[model samples]
Target: MDIDLNTLRASIDAEVNRREFERLPARDDDSLPAAGLIDSVAAFEPIDLEGYLPEPPEEHQHIEPELVAELLPEGRFYNWLKRPPFARHLQRPRIYSLLTRASRLPGGARLSNFIYIMARGIAYRIPALARLLEQSKQWRYLPGRLAGFEYQANQGLYAHALAVQRNERYLLDRLQRLEQRLREQQAQAARTAGAPAAEAASPPAAMPADLYVDFEAHFRGSREEIRQRLAANIPRFKAVAALFSEPVLDLGCGRGEWLQLLQESGIAAVGVDSNPSMVQCCLDAGLQASVGDGLAYLQGLPDHSLAGLTAFHVIEHVPLDVLVRLIDEARRVVRPGGIVLFETPNPENLIVGACNFYTDPTHRNPLPPALVAFLLEARGFIRVEIERRHPADPKLLLQGQDDGLVQPLNRLLFGPQDYAAIGHAP
Candidate 1:
């Protein structure tokens, strides 16, 4: 058989337009012709309309009614109508019979055959009432077909909503890709235009600044929780404060919890962080803080300017070279007999080392307490010690275990979640 592509294309286009038009609400002025009205009335009878009515468009034919119910404006109302008293009344065979018969009548006759069948089946027990209903004239004009119309309307709305949602997602994805491409182009242009050779070399992937701040806020606990945790370190810092005259400095002072604790203890303190929002939070609380790279801020300070230096949960986020330089700067700035503390997630805890350490995308790698202590000693700090804090909950440990293997197993599974390396400036 010869194929006519133009005719097939025209037919498909017409069908698409027809379906789109059917999705629209009926106008008040539109009137059905006598013959069409008769056909419509017959279509609403107890007999199946599925064969008589046009099949739904391919895209909408498989849509589940339950999935689309919430997207419809009258969804709640429809759900309410399906419950108890209203549903019981609709289920009466007398009412359903009347609707089924009237739907076949002329002039304003509209009713759902599917609903009639459903109601008839439910009310089949009351044969006498059904017989009485067959003669009733009062319900002949009832607009029971509105239920069928509502179902069809809901399906159309759901299909339209799904299409719109897909379109929006596609546009958003495209916009993000465009933005990424634009940034890459700008970086390349800068590299070609007299930028430093080192900077032009392969740079590390950086998370968006705002996103990182929000990520930290979500994962790093509330300010009150952090303050409570840092309270344990107060005596340690207080001892160093008594020996030195200069103020303490906290690098990456997220929310300035340590700074606040030190100030409350009558020890002067200052803080520096790269996140502007965190610095703003500190400033709002009447704490002294500035927005800058922690190591860069340390480098700017004169030798023996600070009494103590602390960085809590900050080292894991930086490169090894940056961490070494930060330690070197801490030693140069902190006074003799003053302390330099570096707190980090303890990789000794098997769970923390293998899984939890990667929760923060910014974390470079887990650093062991012994490695930090060695680094501090190598940088000329004396009396280097490791303070294991925030141990795993006692309930997680193996109970009633006297065996040697059990103790070691418990330690491996439920050990200190974090640790701090404290080294004195010599």
Candidate 2:
């Protein structure tokens, strides 16, 4: 070949410039380096020409020559058989329409249900076959689509299990606390047993020994008369009779009239009194009775030990502090929804408050109905109410007077001779 002198001279100059450019250091710009370029041109070594060639697109890339040679031809017939007919996208709509129409026919729903159950049973029985069937839908990526649904279901189950465990733990903790409190109360009672009788009889301390001596003989009425007066309260207790499944405690149970009445009504009752004579009378009448201070007896019992507590004409004998402690102990010892009833001379009635109240030397002071009711509420009792009882005879009222003062005078002179403060434990 013939060479042009001018072109040859230009090519020699370009070759000299290219070698100089290759020897220069790389630029410090953010742009990436060319493929196969080393950190520095000074350390670069020439690679094989084949290694520097551009790679073919992945879609058009060929397999290994030996592997391609071993692969047998996948004929039209084999491909057709390999693909599942039900899974074909083109036929799915037609198959679904046919199934809907068949299901509309009589008994078709039952037949379809039976088939679905059988299919599930077969899948469970042949897990390997089930896995193979699932693999056929790999193109649709069923597992990936169902992943979120499965995660949500598992979360719900976990939350429910956690809630149940927490509730069980809470209930167990409450039970343990109650048991501990009961043990503490028992220990306290044992300690108090060896103490002085005066300490134990805290409430009755307001009453002098002279008052307790022959007090029942001088003040207590006949059993028949007391029973007649107490009979009116039987119906009041009947409504909540079922709540007294456990024994009811009657504090200051004088003469055992209330105990006898409870026995007639088929309710189990126990009596506590500071007076040994009154307790003996209860025992002699086949009633369970104990000679102990009402407040101390209540303190000795465990939480929720009693179903009901009743003290008739007893609270008036105790001081305010003693009455408060008595009510507090009653609240602790009584069960939830249990009854607490206190009957005392009504201070609302002028005759009772000024005259009849002091007839009993043991009475500390007459408690107003409002004060008693308020105390019950303050101590966490519910449904507190004051029920006035033993109204004065109508004949005792000033007759033939249309004046408003007449009614007021009668109320102040007579009104209700006694009142009861009734409450229920929360």
Worst 10 residues of 2 by lDDT: 69-78
Tell me the lDDT of candidate 2.
0.72
Tens digits of per-residue lDDT for model 1, 81-193: 44565544444444434433544545223334435555766566688767666646336635566767888999999999999999998997677546544643544475458
What CA RMSD would you report for each candidate?
A: 28.6, 19.8
Clashing pairs in model 2? none
Query: All candidates' TM-scores?
Result: 0.51, 0.53
Q: lDDT for each of the candidates?
A: 0.72, 0.72
Clashes of each: 0, 0
**Which ranges of candidate 2 are over 4 A from the true structure?**
1-220
Span of 10 residues, lowest total lDDT, candidate 1:
196-205
User: How many clashes show up in model 1?
Assistant: 0
